[model samples]
Target: MSNRNKKIIIYICCAFIVAIIFYLFPHFYSTTMREAFIYFPEDDQIEFIDASTNIKLIDTKDENEYYLEWKTASETDKKAYLRQDIGFIFENGVLISTQSEWREKTKKLKNKVTLHGEDSGRYEAITFHFAEVHYPDDIIKSKQIMTEDKHYVIDTPLSPLVDFKKAKSQSEQRGKELLDSIIDQQLTYTVEGLIEQFKINKESYHIFPLTEIAQFQTEPLPSMSQEETNAVIGRMWEGLYRYYLLGTNTFTEETYDPIGNTMPFVFLSKDDTHLLVLYETADKKGQQLLQLIPKSEDNENLSKNEQ
Candidate 1:
């Protein structure tokens, strides 16, 4: 071949490779990013079972109990089989009993508040099921949990009636402008001001020394809508943590050890999904805000423990 022709062919090849990379990069990124967050089980976990409401009750030897699981699939021409084939979005979700209905066994499932055919929120006294599948060596002793000194509990289902007189007054006087200033100032506010605004009474609420747990940021999982997330928080928790609107972030960095010495703050997400109850110690001299951000599959820090 002529030298000029050879050079042209090389240039064309280089351009084609670059174009292919550009075309394929997005698809590759999307696929890899999604796998991290989605909860699809491996083929080894699938079992043959009858389908009901597009969900299945799988009895795995490891589980020892039958539980509800689901898979998303395309509805099209298919082959016949004794058991339904597992589909795209597979999840070993909430547990269902093999012997009895789950609703009967779940005593805390009572007092459900339904909104638009879904459970909105309610006070349910139920057992928490852990999702971790740990090996024998990795398992912690039950006595260790019982021996832990630091424990907190809700004595009553009802939230202690708070006198929001002080909090209400400040909000009325400051109006919406106060909230704006709180954000622009990066969550700097007077200790007394928030005490009144949120009605945090020593008798009603257990005031704690602001620990690192109260000082982190988080985002909701992608499956949660902002409103749904807010509803979940409101139902599951008590006090000022529930009613905070979007865009409210309050913090004071004055560090104090005793609860009496610290200033309380409200950290709210922009979309109002997540929240943090933080405090500023009396001696610390910086500003902090409860950070609530939306969770995306690609977020490396998305797994932070939440209250």
Candidate 2:
């Protein structure tokens, strides 16, 4: 194909991909899981899976400042998988946030956030799951979580300062409680939003939800509608990092400490299927997926303890 025809083929391919992506809507699944599959787009092929769903995006707005591909489960063919993610960019590096989750055991999973660059040549990206509480509505809930001396218990005692350590600990506990309460309150009150985004996509454009999606026994994945596709095209992640790499750039290797100071990430699933997760960190360059480790068993799968 000539260069002009080749460009036309690319556009036609993108259009067809968008058409397929919007094919599945309003499907629910019995299990909650997502897997990220890496594909070689430049090669015009996908590996490890047959019959994949693809999406091509273009922002008529913003004059095309952002463009990229997201390789994930295809909601249409049900061959794509979904994973809870938390990602953001930071000045020193990216901070991929996470929370600790328990599975009769304990381990970490990197949420959706990613990061790059550090003040020093050294940094580590840590992701894991943590135990947490959920309220029916985002607008109203009692009790909160406060971490004290690296421990967790709901509803810390509130009082004036007694001793500095005790007072500080107590204050931290109160803060957790207050924050949790606020989180619950926002889901129901003036803070609530999202259901509408689903409606228009469902009735008009025919797109589907990426997370919390349900289909037969196939696979579940994220999706997009005309509006969603529109919303995402121009709006690339507004990361706080000083630099970000395009696909062709080189990256440095680094790791972050996954201990006390990291914040917990929480995902509020609207229909018990779709989740809105918030992570407090980012992933370093070249780290695309955070391995999900159950917190018990053993630290057997951890990256051989770098160091």
Best by lDDT: 1
State how far residue 83 of model 2 sits from its true place (Å): 17
Model 1 / residue 252 / CA error / Å: 14
Q: What is the C-alpha lDDT of each candidate?
A: 0.27, 0.24
Cα lDDT for residue 48, candidate 2: 24
- State each candidate's clash count: 10, 53
lDDT of 2 at 119: 15
RMSD of 2: 22.8
lDDT (tens digit, per residue) of candidate 1 on 242-293: 1111112234322222322232344443354454465433343322333343
TM-score each candidate: 0.20, 0.19
Question: RMSD per prediction, one decimal?
Answer: 23.1, 22.8
Off by over 4 Å in 2: 1-168, 187-192, 200-307
